[model samples]
Target: MSGGIGRRALITGAVAGAGTLLSGCDRLGRDERFQRLLRTGEGGNYAVLRLLQDRTALAQEFRPDQRSPVFRMNGVRMPNGDDYARHLATGFADWRIPVEGLVAHPQAYSMAQLRAMPSRTQITRHDCVEGWSAIGKWTDVPLRLLLDRAGVSPQARFVVFHCADPQSNGTMYYESIDRIDAAHPQTILAWALNDELLPPGNGAPLRLRVERQLGYKQAKYVQRIELVSSLAGINGGKGGYWEDVAGYEWYAGL
Candidate 1:
């Protein structure tokens, strides 16, 4: 769960507005070639970058004062359902993140338990595939520590994130990352943004912040974390909701 790109190859912080995210689908959707480029070219680029870059290199971090004036909430604003509403009404007190799959000990962590764990806060920029980006502060427990507590099995090659948000077909939205990104120092399951409890529009209960990748990789409304050996059986099996339907690359390395 560790990997890196070169120090010079890293992006400092290029912030784009939320609008780019909304139009990303149509822009890429209409152009078959553009989508193909990402699929064939970008995917290989990620592998090459991984080999050339330092596995432990970290994304640039900023000060609180440098936070974005407005951090746009992307993806399902609020997943539709009575269960989700009830949890929201109760301020996610009963919500829990179930860690299962290829773990030695399956466990469900309540919000309180997550907050009680050691946490890291960082101000970093988010880059969306569509063309927009923003900088913001996020606070959450290091995902690596959680994986350690769960005792990830040697057979687990990828980490799957089951989210509360639903995709177009009604299946719950989900995403995944290789062991490298999952163990990166900056990758976290952020429960708070901008120094406050995460808002519903921004994945209130929990969201992932895998800073080195594009925004789509930052899954929101995370309900479960499952370590697995393969992504072949999950929903369209491309590794994410957008990737399954919209052809986004699984490793959106930037």
Candidate 2:
């Protein structure tokens, strides 16, 4: 079968599984069956999607004049916690991002230090999983430069971003990227937007800009950077917050 046909079959199977549970008298609800389908098909779906993404052309970028006048911030608008509040109150003077794991050097970089690094500016569109897109300009140090400075180990296959956003159950938000995306030119730790310092509502202090993927891949309010060979033990072992809790695709390649 063609790749497209195969993908369609996989999706159809998953949907059919969901429909069965919805119409049955079984104790398992439709939601449970949907989650089970996602769990069972996640790896294969990711592999197929990744193959297609790798073969496709790079995602389009926007002209500076085409950038949005006001890009609406998606996800947690403001992190709620005493620690985050204290940093905000103090103007983030003591805010630091701890960088460690599978590296020759481990260091805690203050926001000022991160800002001092050489930076890149790009006008790009953020496509959210919920069917919205916004173009904006961003400026930040490339993640590759920071990873290089930290001496990333050869075995490090994934870079995980730990954020400060806390859900009702008190679990922190986190996401991971493989080495290919990690070394991509557009992967940056953004500190500014639209030629101005980042606003608190839009992930002030620092945020990740992973241009090839969707908005959620660009984790906001970043607090820690970890290099890991595998994501088996991080946050329910599904690789990200949404992946663990909402059955969202872990490899959200555009």
Candidate 3:
């Protein structure tokens, strides 16, 4: 069977396990949430995978020759807001990603300042909840560097990414991850893709590339990273737009 056929079969099984009786994969094709279960083929995180993953294992990284010819843009393509516009007009020279909330030293980092820091370049496959995948070379500053610089408070348990894009429902797009994923070697604030400055369509200025999670967890247009003790009081209080609105698993480990 072709890779496409096998992947579609996997997707069908993943969705069917959600208790949605499907005559076929057609009508349910549009529902792309809750796909992180594919790690062990169950709708919930498998016990063994979750246990070993606690050791901070790295995701599968690909070689440069394996990079996809084109990486498709998912979710909000361009933010429709005045702030993003102002940043875009200046080529994001004035863009500053603020680190606030439960950190000891709050700081806003500039693009140039970030680029000057020690960076990592990884060629990794981006697994989207949509069941499609793309491999691209991404250059980014390790998220751990920023957290170390800000001195994450002892009470801080989760890192929340605030983005510039607002949904049609009038809420801004944001996502959160635990300190484990935030400290992963592959997890980065990617600013460039395929050796080029990140395109606006692909989250220019900065975006989170938490390699171990599915794509929706990769928040784009990130403007601030707020360290917090809990997710209880944020928008919808579930830690992410999809998690709150669409019932996606908060810890979507791949």
Candidate 4:
């Protein structure tokens, strides 16, 4: 079997066992063996995933005929906060995405300005960390163009995305990408999908489409972009929400 298949199978087995254990009892504190087994199993799977991502080339896109009949939304379906609700009421007319951080020039851009920039469209596959995939066409402005316009400084090595979705207590969704992926031709801030205006369920108004990585890395409902030299000072200091909270790999470059 291929490396991906092998790794996926192992992860599946571990998850199954973990689920069984958790179902049997709620006291993870009492089950030291179960806790150790779960952690080790998850770690092994993550390590293998990282290895596969590091060794593999960019994922392949597809022809129009190969696209999915139903490209379901994978992340936040609707943001419930008052701020998001206000924007939605106005049809996002007042929403401005703040672009700041270590750049020579920091600015706020409206959705109109983003839509006005030169754009690229691609029918790429969206691979989820949960082991599912779908193909959908994306239309957006190349991320490099926006970065260039803001004059990203040489010191800026990573771009952090701040979003509107809240995942847990006092926690927000965020992700970061290195300069390499930022400059990729396929990297975009998508505003449309499958030839339709982006839906609220699929990060309407704006979203990041870092085609080279998994779906989680494609942060949705993006409200801000921060350029930084390092990811050390961010929440949990692991570069992303899932990475920090759930031990997902930070550099999911697949």
Q: Pick the candidate with the highest lDDT.
A: 1
Candidate 2 per-residue lDDT over residues 48-96, each given as its tens digit? 7667765424567779999887899877888998988898888889988
Model 1 spans > 4 angstroms off: 1-38
lDDT, candidate 2, equals: 0.85
Q: Which stretches of candidate 3 lie over 4 Å from their true place?
A: 1-48
Q: What is the C-alpha RMSD of each candidate to the true structure, in Å?
A: 12.8, 8.1, 9.1, 9.1
For each candidate, give its TM-score against the true structure. 0.84, 0.82, 0.82, 0.78
**What is candidate 3's lDDT per residue for 122-181, written digit by digit as tens?**
999889987999999999999999999999999999999999899888899999998878
Please write out the lDDT profile of model 1 over residues 1-254, one tens digit for every residue.
23475444444322233456558867886787886775677768897989986876899999888878999878788889999999999999999899999999999999999999999999999999989989999999999999999999999999999999877788888899999988899999999999899999998899999988899899899999999899999988888888888777888986
Q: Encode model 4's per-residue lDDT on 10-73: one tens digit a residue.
A: 9999999989888777776448787667667666765676566543245577898899999888
Q: Which stretches of candidate 4 lie over 4 Å from their true place?
A: 1-58
Model 4 RMSD in Å is 9.1
* Candidate 2: regions farther than 4 A off: 1-45, 52-57
Ranking by lDDT: 1, 3, 4, 2
lDDT of 2 at 196: 90
TM-score of 4: 0.78
Per-candidate Cα lDDT values, in order, are 0.89, 0.85, 0.87, 0.86
TM-score of 1: 0.84
Q: Of the pair 3 and 4, which is ahead by lDDT?
A: 3
